[model samples]
Target chain A: MAKVLMKGNEAIGEAAIRAGCRYFFGYPITPQSELPEYMSLHLPKAGGVFLQAESEIAAINMVYGASGSGARVMTGSSTPGIALKQEGISYIAGAQLPCVIVNMMRGGPGLGSIQPAQSDYNQSTRGGGGGDYRLLAYAPASVQEMVDYVQLAFDKADEYRNPVLVVGDGVIGQMMEPVEFRATAASDLPPKDWATTGTGGKRPPNIINSLYLDAEELERHNIHLAEKYNRIKENEQRWESVGLEGAELVIVAYGTTARIAKSAMENLNRQGKKIGLLRLITLWPFPEKGFAELDEATKDLLVVEMSMGQMVDDVRIVNEGKRGVHFVGRSGGVIPSTALVEEKILEILERSE
Target chain B: MVNERTILAGFGGQGVMLMGQLLTQAGMIEGKEVSWLPSYGPEMRGGTANCGVIVQTEPISSPVVEGNATSEIMMNTPSLDKFEKDLVPGGKLLINSSLISKKASRDDVEAYYIPSSDIANELGDTRIANMVMLGAFVELTGAVEPESIFQALESRLGLARAHLMDINKQAFARGAACVKEQRN
Candidate 1:
């Protein structure tokens, strides 16, 4: 296929449109502003609706409204802006709506900086908003994956009847890549029988709300979500393990950070260093099984990340403290050097031997 | 397989971003995994434009290329000041002799002070200087097939540009020939 050069943010907008996502509501934010801008220009031309909501909160609710009416909908924001949409995200998850929310993450505790950072790892994987809900999160390392995941996110959301988050760092959102536009029809996805599309006279008015006054009703809802989550754990865990066997150390990373670690690992391996990389493609559901094997393979493990020490904590848990899990990270938008990562790996290998 | 990483930097109009994109697309066409990452900043406000391209046999995990140990930097003056120290040992340094009069200070990194702008001007448009550097990059590093690169460019360029395709092909050919002539 002839690959067309496209920016990561614009590719997401195009992918969503091609995937039968006709309704897009979003507010502008740096590193991700191109997404809404692209949608504003392309959606109307594609015979779709593109609304620039007043705020992140309003944009997410607009997504909620559109998704409720059985339309494939999406909204995008940066870290701080995404934080504002949490209340709405929780509501979407609670109501079991199928929609895609893109968090082109930036450095932050509160508007920290516009540079890309994976500090939102905990916020995204755990609970960014509030509730016993889990967003099926996909971390895209490349622009191609960024585009492909938008379609995948929509499909997964509809299949599970849940809100799926396409989480990416600012770098991923801003970078340009050569990508071939692949088309997939909306009808190719699962049917939306449960959607509140005016009930279609087959049933009465269906309510999509998170509030359940009765404890039993809430419990039932929780159980149902739990069952769905279990299925997600079983069938939805996506990961990539490189050179794990006969390795002395395993490095766990994801997204752009993981790609850098791969280079570092290759350089080290060429020098006769026994090293491997375990990359988590799906950030949510955490890929416990993938980490379990890495823990068993090598006593020395390194968790390199673009965050302070968030994903490193998960490495510690899966290692069960039996293996030495060391963390090497650069926070506040500073990407760790490959040499720095190599130095850490050499240090771990030396210590282990 | 030959693995190469380049950090091209200059002002926004230098077409550094396009060079990175062309190289990445070429790599992809040769059935290699490619990644292109831009310098993290506002692009249009006359800010310094920097971009990284990784062309390799294996999948690229990280797009962020560091200054230290970054081999083969194609820089234009101030960009050389910012990123030259990052070049790896035995890495070639290509400079725009037209715009960047002052050469690289480092002794360890091999420097090629090509009059890139003069060469681009002779070719009619300095915009494809990035493409010229990319042609040089492929010849020097052999990260992917040069034939594959021309093919990718031909197929990937938009229809609006169909009229100007032959000129670009010549530009890339000139770039490759320049490297060969230098070697001879």
Candidate 2:
């Protein structure tokens, strides 16, 4: 495969196509408008279904309807737009349908800014919609990773019969990178025995609906999802560590901040600084074990984010006050520079010394 | 392994970000680790936009470049004003003379102001201006091989855009000539 320069959002759309995702429904939003735009152009050429739904509510519901038919369906939106679709997402989970959702997160509690931000961490992981449901969330920091995770998200969703979320920020959505894409197999997916493709000689007609109206049945469904979640924690935990040997300070971050933190560590290492990076690739099943393992040897721990201490709260919980934990963040869409990280690291070092 | 960092900045439509991407892709084709990060959110479409690209011979430890990159490309007067002091001392600077009237401030830096937009228009397309600047940078700094850059561009152009590859190839040659003429 040859490297092709592709925008992050467009790459997400193309990767879905290559992954045999034939149904797409989305509305327009900033920092991710290119996603729907690209889908509009390529989906038809690939003989796939593309719909410009009337609203995000309609878009997500359309995804639910398509995925019920056993097709790989997807929809993308930004933070605010995703919030509007949460109601439908809850329904999708209640039905236990396989689908893919992408949130190109932007800053804010309410229309804050279009800048990249990690403020949606808690909302994304803790079930933004309703009910006891957990969405497998994959956080990608770069354009190439964005493409990789889109394909992975579909595969995971189908495997678990649950929706998987690809959570990225505007930075990951808007940037460009050289990517070599693998073509998706159109017929390689497992047959959807549960799809409502009409019943002829089948044992029984398959029906997929969220309304159970039975307490015991709903409890069983919730327990089933919980079991799947536990299995995911054991098998799907993904993270990366750089320069962990003899490290004095450990920096924990995900998405764009993680990329910057890695750069700062390299620069610091050149200047004789003992620093390492623990980058979370799966933000939902937060790599709690990675940070919990840092005992007395790790002098300082820093959680870098593009929000007002959203993921930092998780880092602190995992640390359990065993070591000094600090946070460095920038809100409302401003990405912190490497110099700011260096200053923060140096400050921690000074305090430790 | 040397990590070649660059920050290209200009007004919204000056093609500064495109030049950054072109260089990054060229580096990637050469089997180098590369990343292209552009300004997003509020500054992307309307306000000033910039892109940071880091290319290294080894696995890239970090994708972000702190302070200033080893090279800087400015396309407008405002961009020169904003990024003049950010260039690494004695680093390479390429300006679009047709758009950027003011030159970089640091004398320690090697600066060249080419009429990239004018040359591109003469070559029959204004969009190729970024490619011209890309070519000039390769010739002036030898940061990347000129042939590799063209091949990278052609591959990235894809089947949908194979017709425009000739224009890009020509634009690269013109920019390279512009740099050689100055060197002589």
Candidate 3:
């Protein structure tokens, strides 16, 4: 394949378009502005709609409207902007719409800096929007994965009839790389009988709404969503582990941090350090089994991240705190140096002895 | 496996970002893994605009350039002052001698002086100074084929600037000739 070189943000836009996503409604934000810009130029040319809404709040609702009408819809934003779209995201999830939201996360607690940060892990995996619903989140590390995951995310979103989040950091959004656009048509997408596409007077019109007047009725809806969530957890927990076979320590990371962690793991391994990496591609499913299957020789686990140890909590729970689990991270757009990560692993090994 | 972590830095109008993009695209043409990351925010508006370009044979992790660069192209004195310390020992440094007055003092690196702006000026367009440096850097590092860079440049400029195409090509050739002449 004659691969094309593209920036991560631009590649994501092209991937979404290739995946049959015709509708893109987004407002501009740092590190992810290229995504909306690309869509604006291409979506209309592809016979799709691209609307730059007045704000992130307005843009996500536009996604809801388009998704309800049976368009493969998407929107993107950085950290603070994504935060603003929470209400609309909740509404989309409540209505059970299949849409993709790309959050190229930046530093945040308030209106944080425009630099990359993974502090949104708790928000993305737990709940960025208010609800009992979970977004099927894909944490891609490389620009190629950033492009590849869109088609998969859209497919998963449609299959589950729910919202999916491609949660990458600023680096994944802004970095440029060579990526092959292996065309993945959201092919085999099931019929959207549930969509609010206008009925041609042959049958009852499909209505998309989340409100239930009766508590029991709402309970039933909640149970249905729960069942699907549990099924996804059981069937769709995706992860990658390297060098866990005979290692004394394993590093748990995802997104850009996972990429750095792999480099550190390899560099240390070359120097005879026993280290491994467990990368979570699907952050929402939280791959508990990947943790359980850790090599027996693994005596300790280190959770390395770009945030101040957000993912470490999950590492502690799954590992049962039975093994020494250490956390090393930096927030506010700082990526931990690979050398520093290697040093931490060596330090952990030394301390345990 | 070959790896080149580079920083092409200069004034905002020096086309440093575009040069980074061209190199990244050239690397892709050769079927190598590559990454280009621009220095964003306030620094972009100031004279010191820079972009990190990484070309490797393996999947790139971190994307951050970290400390020292394996190869560097500095177009102005500020860029030279800022990034000279970050150039790795035994790495290649291409200085735009037209704008930069000081020569690199480090003995650990291979520093090549190219009057890229002067060469582009001779071609009747100083805008191609970035391309001029690109020509010399690629020749010295074997980063990519000269034809690949020409292909990248044409595509990058598109038809909007078709009239300037001849001069740009001339600028690239002159820069490469300058380096070859120096070696001779």
Candidate 4:
């Protein structure tokens, strides 16, 4: 297919349609409002349902109901809106329903700035609601990745029967770029025999519920979820490494921050500084495998983010104090400049020297 | 590595976003990597608006022009005041002389002043000032062909607004001529 220019949010919506997602339930929010708007316009024409629910809470529950009935469903919102859907998300996760959730993050402790941010890293990677469940989260950096990941997210969601998240900051949601929707070979997914698709009196009814009243049964269910999470950790970790061979420092970042760090790395590398980048594509799986394979010459690890320090904790956990871990971040809608990043790296390199 | 990072800034209705989009579209038409990021949210309602556009042969590392802008196109005085310092040393500055009165304070960069609104007015449409600025950028940098921009505009405007194509082309030509005259 020919490349077409599209905004990230609209591209995600189109990709979902191409992935055979037939139901969308979402509320409008800045930065990501375009996604739901795009769906409302085009999904109906594709013989799908696009619904604007009353609240974020209502929207997610609608996704829950739709997914329970064997439909590929999705819901999207910005940070605070995503917070509102957490309880419903936990329920969906516990019920083992396959759905895709998109969170185009904005700055927030509560109703903060409307600009782009990565503050929701912990909330997304670690569960936001009360649950022992885990979500398969993909943090895409570009519009093209957003398109490709949204499709992959659907397939992954269905394969695991768990909700998958395609999380990008406001920039990825708002930016426009050329994207080609490459033809994706359909995955050999397991049949939805577990869905509540009206038994027609020929088979037993399939019940979709997360509630477990029996203490031992709930423990068993928790253990089962833990095993699924372990499997995901083993097989689904995804990351990208650049210039890792004999690097003096490795910068860990994701989403838009990773892109900025890449520019900074390129600039510094041109000036004979040995800097590498490890860009995490899956936030939940945490890409621990990338950390384990870090170049032996890398003496320092700098974690960059839009939030003050969330993903850094994960990096620290994975690094195990082998290298000096550093952090540089900006919050409240301020995107870290390439100059600032370059300065930070120079400072770290000087300190190590 | 023909990387051109441009910041286009103006008031809400000045069509700065459209200018960035057209530049990016033209870049894409030429098979170059490009990205366009707009200043969105409440600021876009009635206040100042801006966008960063990157066009290059290599993959764009960042879509932001916050600190590494190679050029700036300012449609108003405040925009010039705001973004003049963001440009890298030896960068290009294009100002809309019709709306901005002050000269660019920076001496390290190449500055071009075009009364874009006046040129657009002369060309029979005040709204084409952004196109004029875009044309000047294209002529100065040759980042993308003028013909590619025309193709981009035609596809963007579609068949419904096909009649406006000639005027937009004229505005673009006037913009290019303004730059040529200044250089001469």
TM-score of chain A of 1: 0.96
In order, the TM-score of chain B in each prediction is 0.89, 0.89, 0.94, 0.97
Could you say which candidate leads in TM-score? 4
Candidate 4, pairs of clashing residues: none
Q: Regarding DockQ, does 2 or 4 come out ahead?
A: 4
Runs of candidate 1 exceeding 4 Å displacement: A1-4, A178-190, A199-202, A295-297, B67-75, B119-184
CA-RMSD of model 2 = 3.0
Docking quality of model 1: it rates as: medium
Model 2, residue A78: C-alpha shift (Å): 1.0
Candidate 3 per-residue lDDT, tens place, A168-207, comes to: 8888888887788885754777899988877889789898
* Chain A TM-score values, per prediction: 0.96, 0.96, 0.98, 0.99
DockQ, 0 to 1 scale, candidate 2: 0.58
Model 4 alpha-carbon miss at residue B87, Å: 1.3
Window of ten residues with lowest summed lDDT in model 2 chain B: B59-68
- True-structure RMSD, every candidate: 3.0, 3.0, 1.9, 1.0
The candidate scoring highest on lDDT is 4
In angstroms, the error of model 3 at A342 is 2.0
Q: DockQ for all models, in order?
A: 0.55, 0.58, 0.69, 0.91
Per-residue CA lDDT of model 2 for A1-353, tens digit only, reads 88777888999999999888998999999988999999999998999989999999999999999999899999999999999999999999888889999999898988778888889999888877889888889998877788888998898888878899998888788877778886654535566788888888757889998886899998898898899889888888788887777789999998988988887888799999999899999987878767655645688888899988888777878877877889998888888887888899999999999
Candidate 1 has a DockQ of 0.55
